[model samples]
Target: MIKLYGMTGSGNCWKPAVLMKQLGQPFEWTEINTLKGETRTPEFLALNANGRVPLLIVNGRKLAESNAMLCYLADGTDYFPADRWQRAKILEWMFFEQYSHEPYIATVRFWVHFMQKQEEWKDKIAEAMKKGHAALGVMEQQLQKTSFLAGARYSIADIALYAYTHVAHEGGYDLNAYPAINDWMKRLEAQPKFEKMTG
Candidate 1:
């Protein structure tokens, strides 16, 4: 069995949780309240030097970074591509999600959903939202050309970005304006094994 340390509502953490259930794997989940600095403690730091949520403890090995875990768990699974070029494309999207998508999407989600844009984060929300929209546009353009991020098949590349793109509206980015993303979201939702982060 695997053990996972996560915050209840975190998009990064939710990625593995949803995938585990979708994959029919059994794992233990320990909720860590990041708002209370639970992850910064020495105990958690030993697990992940970065002190981040979405830590995966499998076979006594601990790993951090949500996208990394997605790739790790997907070994020998359909979510992992068999072809070298397709596999590279999957990794490409995973890297894109971390560098280009999460900063804006997750940050804006924090302001709109949790803080209500009430603090110093307020001044930067608009700009962040703009970048977030641009990131979605990048996904939209790819999705329009291909059925999935890598190709026709669903892969961890989809899982990586799907972690937050589904709820980008929580960040005040309108999905209605993105027909391709909206359509893609529905397709993901329609997967028979689909599991949602929030009830």
Candidate 2:
């Protein structure tokens, strides 16, 4: 069985959980309470020196990084593309997701919803959100033109961004301005095997 260490509400963690449900794969979830410093402990640190959640332990070997794990589990599955160029395109979007998208989107959620009254990050929070919406604007532009991010078909790229984007409001970004993004989000939610991140 695959064992996953992640916080339930995290977009990165939700990536695998959502994929498992969509693919009908069997797995066990062990939520790592980062708020309690569970991920920083010796045992957890051994799994990932970065001390991040969403670690996938398969057959005693651990894989870190949420998007990387998504690629691993999704290989040869419907979520993965068979065409090399298309696969490359998917990777491009995945890279953009981690670099351009996650920093802002995830940070906003962390600051606004999760961090709460932690004044330490208040300034960074406000700054991240402004950048976050700009990132969403990129998505809105792509969603306006293309049905999905990578190819004409739905792929892991959609799943990669969907986790945080769907809940972007929690980060204080208004979705009403991006009708195309909202429509695309609704389409993803309407998929036959779609799964929600909130447990």
Candidate 3:
């Protein structure tokens, strides 16, 4: 059986859970509370040197990194395209989500919602908001032209961005400003077997 170790509230962790459900893959989930320093423990470190949640253990092989796990799970499936260029395009958006979008958007969400350090991290939050909005603007532009990030079809690229983008309001981002993104989100939610984040 496949096993996942993660906090349900984390968007990164929630990514694979939603995908697994959508793909009809059965798995066991074990919650690890990072806020309580569970991830820093030696046992957790042995599974992931980076000491992060969203670790996937399959047949004794452990995989770290949510996006990497997504690629692994979605490979050869409709979520990952068969066409070389189309796959590359999906990867492009996935990479952008990690580098440009997650840093600011997810970070602020972590700070404001999880840590409740909005005042303590005011300066940092302000900076993240600016950069996060910029990332959203980029997404808005692409979403304006295409139904999905890679193209008309939904892919892991959409899943990657949707994980954080949907709950961006937790970080104080206003979705009302991005009509295309809102529409795309609605479209994604309308997908069959779609699951909401657990926490």
Residues 72-158, candidate 3: write the lDDT tens digits. 999999999689999999999999999999999999999999989999989989988999999999999999999999998999999
Top candidate, metric TM-score: 3
- How accurate locally, in lDDT, is each candidate? 0.86, 0.86, 0.93
lDDT of 3 at 41: 98
Candidate of highest lDDT:
3
**Against the true structure, candidate 3 has what lDDT?**
0.93
TM-score per candidate, chains pooled: 0.95, 0.94, 0.98
Sliding window of 10 residues with minimal summed lDDT for model 2: 117-126
Give one digit per residue, the lDDT tens place, for model 2 in 25-58. 8999997888899999998888899999899989
From the highest TM-score down, the ranking of the candidates is 3, 1, 2
Global fold similarity of model 2 (TM-score): 0.94
**Over the stretch 89-185, how does candidate 1's per-residue lDDT look in tens digits?**
9999999999999999988897878767646677698878788889999999998988888889888888889888987877777788778887887
Greater-TM-score candidate between 1 and 2 = 1
lDDT of 1: 0.86
